[model samples]
Target: MRMMTCRLCGSDDLTGVVDLGATPPCERILTADQLDEPEVTYPLHLRVCTSCWLAQIPPLITPEETFTDYAYFSSYSASWVEHARAFVAGLDLRPDSFVVEVASNDGYLLRHVVERGVRCLGVEPSVNVGQAARERGVPTVTAFLTPESAQAVVAEHGKADYVVANNVYAHIPDVIGFTEGLRTLVADDGLVSVEVQHLLTLMQLNQYDTIYHEHFQYYTVASAQRALASGGLTLVDVELLTTHGGSIRLWAAPSGAPSQRVSDVLAMEKAAGLHDISGYIDFTERVAKVRRDLLSFLITAAEEGSTVVGYGAPGKGNTLLNHCGIRPDLLPYTVDRNPYKHGKFTPGARIPIFEPERIAADKPDYVLVLPWNLRDELIDQLSYIRDWGGRLVFPIPTLEVV
Candidate 1:
């Protein structure tokens, strides 16, 4: 709604692309009493900056507003905690090592480091989650991450040896300020690792749902290098992670540090066309194809009097369901493996959530795999649906029956 400058390239030259219509925040699930009131909506439009090649939505909300009352918990995914633990173990943490996590929720990763006799602190913005982290023995600061907050953290816990920010890199509106905080918090020799969903994957896979108000910028390694360099840091290493389709985990230190994976991965991205706008333009066409195919399949199914139910209540699922403009009329309900989301309602579409066991009783003709990123895992979980003469539908990348 406000001025639309690309956060990555600082370019004011942007063109309007796809619009997903007016919708509420995907995580703001409403109760029965709150359904009658009007909801806030921002321009859910995608734009490409001609200068920077960054694809992003408008920054309607600041980082402090977005993360201060965080709802999505990292521990919801089974593999994420293990991923965090492995990171700690690989870092060679010692008893005196001080590891800090920015935007730590529920002490998911810090607990592992703390158990190994290493001192740990979580700089969580959400009061509810910050309280939970403290209760679990993770020393936490219940405030936003800024230069001021970083100084306070250093005063309280000394300089950190390892600072991690998994999947929170894209959430910050002030990329320069956040990286500045990282510089202030981490010791000169310490490392700062940040994980963000690869923009290339989103383009190739047509994962339009990953674009939300909370995510200020979609990052590629190139964009990350530029942002980090602004704060006098350099991306020294990078790893291609399997989480969230595919992501880049970057290891940064002061500029001119020796590392193995920096130039190779940057070359890999450049070789794969990450630096050019043509790559994104090609992807826009592919995404349009997916949108067309997905709509056709859903419309045909409904016309043929088919029963369709979705599987997985993942945040990405909310994005897919909302972007597709699907409601209970098109997909009546969805089943989830996580008990916390079971019996809850989806945010925008208000689709009913049920336990995975409900699939047996309902016997829907097709179970749309909402979390298509984990297609294999979800298919394994719901393989029994085939016994009842049902099929699985994967809607992203393309609409296909599994």
Candidate 2:
């Protein structure tokens, strides 16, 4: 694939900061019958824009190919459900208010909005997830969010009072078009809250596994502000979140919205050297250390006559496993709560995925928590592993056996 320009700034002056070699499409888990088929892999190379300091990968895969018939279901996660509930409870909503969620996966968050008697709509590209949302009584449009789609939504149901985009910002390749949709769909006095994994946290914690083809852009406060502003939205508030390793919930609106905490967050990012290339220089080396540490741990466990299994079949887990060259010989099999992925194999690594019961049945010596961002939650759920003297392992940031 040819190298492309930056998504945010449209600048050609991009520097290669980190490369994870070639990796399979993160979400394209396969069934056993298809294992013998040839699978395509793309370069997992990340580039930083010298002008805007936005860390992104070239859009090698189109949005349609990535999101259609998606396998990720948000409602399977207990903590994420509670997070959605808390967010809904905090919202100052009335029965008549309109709430719209972009990339609303299976109405995981909008169900709360609907239960509150508020009118809610979900815009999802994936047909299966969008159908699920509709079956749950949430109004859903099965299409990607673009300016044209946003205008149609506004014309049909009127402008939304609150637009919530959680964890969808990073997946957008056309940042301008997606943000334009936000601007077009929102009311004059409407509020928009976007949650994205903070680039600062990704670097600080060595969470390089989060780098995937689907995640086209990684944003800092400064880069996010620039992208939003380009689409005629102004950042108003920024709240740091502990979810997804770490993230920033940015509140935005039309030009006249109050700047509640935007300046403070920007200042913090600038202080952390996110405004320049210096902050990104040592990231490749840090990521390499994580790869080495994880492989060493897994190899040592195998040599000592212990078995190591994985806990989750997340997209990030695919990146980590493929990058570290892990296969069934090392991890054997992993498990996930999502039944859609239960019978499938992880892309690239082709590790078989089973139900959570398999972990208890196998009684492995170590359970590598692939989704380390949810380490606390997974540990609680799989605490029964401790009954058999099995420990949990975290690979990113550093190797930790708990």
Best by TM-score: 2
Q: Could you give candidate 1's per-residue lDDT for residues 14-47 as a string of tens digits?
A: 8654566666676665556566677676667777
Q: In model 1, which runs have C-alpha deviations exceeding 4 angstroms?
A: 15-18, 258-260, 337-344
Tens-digit lDDT track of model 2 for 236-353: 8889999999999999999665464777777777887778877888988999899999999888889999999999999999999999999998889999999999889999999999
**Residue-level lDDT for 11 in candidate 1:** 80
**Which regions of candidate 2 fall more than 4 Å away from where they truly are?**
1-3, 257-260
TM-score of model 2 relative to the true fold? Answer: 0.98
CA lDDT, every model vs. true structure: 0.79, 0.91
Cα TM-score per model: 0.92, 0.98
